[model samples]
Target: MNKKTVKSFRPISWPTKGASAKTGKWRTMRPVIDKEKCIACRICYIYCPEATITPEIEIDYEYCKGCGVCAHECPKKAISMENEVH
Candidate 1:
């Protein structure tokens, strides 16, 4: 019988800035979270491709591309997409 060693999982360390640029600058729409309605489920944080949303539900607009994934995945409908003003 052969025994295999199981490897523990480790998360990747993401860089502060993407290779392209600060993606937020190109965003046409931004996600707005209604804190009053938010339950802090971390759904948006898990689904965000940019990983711009924190576990505390705070969004880092500097890196966020405003893809609307957070708004779409929000079960409570607390996140809404609005046109980015400047």
Candidate 2:
């Protein structure tokens, strides 16, 4: 297998200004965590393409887009998507 032929896994159309301008920065979105539902499986941390999830059992809101990938892949269904109040 040629290394040059390997397909890349990267995010597309990520706005440089981020979700909005209200935050005055490149903000992604909010990622909500339910401690009751979370089993500490760390799937969010494992599957986050943005590297937004952390091993500290928390989701990095600054990087998370509320994409629901964590919730979709979550075996425990611990994550949820919500609009930020910003």
Candidate 3:
């Protein structure tokens, strides 16, 4: 039988304890979308690092970290970062 050499450390099993935490709880600001101004280009959804922005332009605050990547990358200037009320 031929033997193969291992190249790098690739862990198979991973822990998911804190991986699904709702990061939006600590957000100082949140992205608010203006439906009227939005062009539905999906730029925000593409730029969102957390994958929180949906294709329909709806923001999933549950996992949103409020990094503002979506707002900054929006070409139509439809997404805005506002102070979180709570």
Candidate 4:
């Protein structure tokens, strides 16, 4: 009996430095975590598409796209999307 073999494909190139991709500049709004209300539940961190939410519950504005996923998913409503000043 003869068996057929399949070849796997991988990405030709990968991002070199960071995940930012300079998306922050396009965002009109930004997420602000209310530390006073935050429960440290990590919901925001998990929902951040850009992975901009840090382990210490800080949002890295440099990469955040203002998608509002973190604010929408926060159970405690600790995250809010505010208009970007600049």
Candidate 5:
């Protein structure tokens, strides 16, 4: 009779939750922006590491993680992280 055993596998650098560090800080989903506050200054668009914010266009929620970075960066503070009205 013959028998075989399967070997267990594990990743060297396991990418778990919030694995990527943002400037020595860990981060997960991030925010886009609210065009109402955006005055074409392009501040958020310039500082965005992920290049998620749109230029002269409303936020593209498809890529936005809603981290509130853009809201904090806004010069006018026009952006805010508001939860669903419901």
Candidate 6:
């Protein structure tokens, strides 16, 4: 039996700062929530890829990518994607 020699392994560098990348500016469309239509089911929060949706169903536009996943997945159709103003 032949034994293989192990080489040095690189350590993964994890980001210490929380979501420093502000990608919202790159978004062409933004999600707007209708309070009246919203049932606060937290469906949008669960579907948000950027995790910008709060527990209260408020979207943090700073980190939101405007992917529209939330709006699409919204059961109540409370979320709407609107054109972002530059």
lDDT by residue (1-86, candidate 6, tens digit) is 22233333734334553445678787899899999999999888887888889999888887788899999999988888999996
What does candidate 2's lDDT look like per residue over 17-55, in tens digits?
A: 344333312434456789998888888889887766788
Top-scoring candidate (lDDT): 1
User: How do the residues 1-86 of candidate 1 rate in per-residue lDDT, one tens digit apiece?
Assistant: 22233333634333446756778887889999999999999999999998889999999998888899999999999999999987
Q: How far out, in Å, is residue 36 in model 6?
A: 0.2
Model 6 scores a TM of: 0.78
Model 1: worst 10 consecutive residues (lDDT sum): 1-10
- Per-residue accuracy of model 5 over 1-86 as CA lDDT, tens digit each: 22233334532334443344332122244343455656888777775555556686456554455666777778977676765321
After best superposition, candidate 5 residue 17: deviation in angstroms?
A: 21
* TM per candidate: 0.78, 0.61, 0.76, 0.76, 0.50, 0.78
- C-alpha displacement of 66 in model 1, angstroms? 1.0
lDDT scores of the candidates, listed in order:
0.86, 0.67, 0.82, 0.80, 0.56, 0.82
Off by over 4 Å in 6: 1-20
lDDT of 6 at 20: 55
Instruction: State how far residue 23 of model 4 sits from its true place (Å).
Output: 1.3
lDDT tens digits, residue span 1-86, model 3: 22234334744333553365678797889999999999999988888888888898898887788899988998888888999976
Q: State model 1's lDDT.
A: 0.86
TM-score for model 3? 0.76
How well is each residue in 21-78 modelled by candidate 4, as lDDT tens digits?
6777878988888889999999788878778888789887877889999999999998
Task: Mark the regions of model 4 whose C-alpha exceeds 4 Å error after superposition.
Answer: 1-13, 17-20
